[model samples]
Target: MRMKKTTTAAIGAAALLSGLLTLAGAPAAHAADGCNNDNGRTVRTAFGGKGQGFELRVNGSGNSTCAWGRIVGGAPGMHVWVDRSSDGGRTWEPQLGWAEISSGGSIWTEAWRDSNGRLMRACGDSGYNTAITCTTWY
Candidate 1:
């Protein structure tokens, strides 16, 4: 039940891009009708760390039209980021975060794994929409 994801991976201002880091995101299209989505369900997530897991960043509006995206389509503050816990998903990095709060929000993100291996990722404002959302897989 993986949802189609859309995203933008712009790191720093274009003036600082070094062509090293990847700032790519998911596609733009959204589900035709998340109608099947349960009621009162917010925060949509998928995962693969150790135990069964997935976390919802936001609540389900039950519209199926709502997803991890800019509140108004292509906003400039919200974004997505991800980190890993090679040490058995115990400790993560000090940084390696994502969001759009700095710029007032950028866009929400669809979570998923990059390969066939088990993966888990996510994207969303911490809560107040002050930082960019993020997603990562491994």
Candidate 2:
């Protein structure tokens, strides 16, 4: 009947408007801040003198990890590295070093396999020896 047709048209119009509104309000997908990768797992800690810190992230693919370091309060001559582990946190591989002189901050990334589940350890140095700050496992 006429009422049934009008009701169907109203429902269709409402559905179309809802879909349009959802699309209009949607935001574009963006990679994680700093690391430029989709980090599904994250670990953060402080290192060196006060205000210095390190963060490690594992990509969603579980085949890569990224490390970021920052020296707050105007610290200079920063150094960083990421150590990968496959046996939980019991053992860490050799230090995968990162460049220094990043007065503001620095980021580093490396590929890895997730067969045994992966782990990443971040280390930072203001000027002296490097030390572990945080560890992330995925």
Candidate 3:
């Protein structure tokens, strides 16, 4: 009976490990710039428009070495982008370029390297004449 229980426990552990490995092998979301959004976390969020239906997210890499923008509830022709600043969000240094949501209601923009005390933020336009919204600097 003891041997039987040990065999069962070993089988269960092997199954669990196999499942974990499968998940770990899953592909990550990659942008044209080759940055992986799967390694990032949303550092800030902002809402806009009626009932706050539109959403903007500022995602930062796990190591704080990269940042990007993502828009949810977006529409075709809508736009999203990431901004970077070297002076603590006082003024924009350069933008990472905009991503037009050509289809669906969600999209991710190109990533920008966040280095040298740079701050990053997410911004978007609904393309419906509504005012643009931006998340706070991270």
The local distance difference test score of each candidate is: 0.34, 0.53, 0.69
* Candidate 2 lDDT tens digits, 44-116: 5555565565555455443333433333342556665566666876886645545365545554444333334
Candidate 2 or 1, higher TM-score: 2
Highest lDDT scorer:
3
User: Over the stretch 1-138, how does candidate 1's per-residue lDDT look in tens digits?
Assistant: 123222232334443564333433432223333322233233444432222122333223322222222222323333344343335445643222344434432343332222222222353443443544433432
Backbone clashes in model 2, listed as residue pairs:
none
Please give the lDDT score at residue 92 for candidate 3.
Answer: 81
TM-score (all chains, Cα) for each model: 0.26, 0.49, 0.63
- Give the range of the ten consecutive residues with the poorest summed lDDT in model 3: 50-59
TM-score for candidate 1, please give it: 0.26
Rank by lDDT, descending? Answer: 3, 2, 1
The alpha-carbon lDDT assigned to residue 39 of candidate 2 equals: 44
Stretches of model 1 off by over 4 angstroms after superposition: 1-74, 94-120, 126-138
Clashes of 2: 0
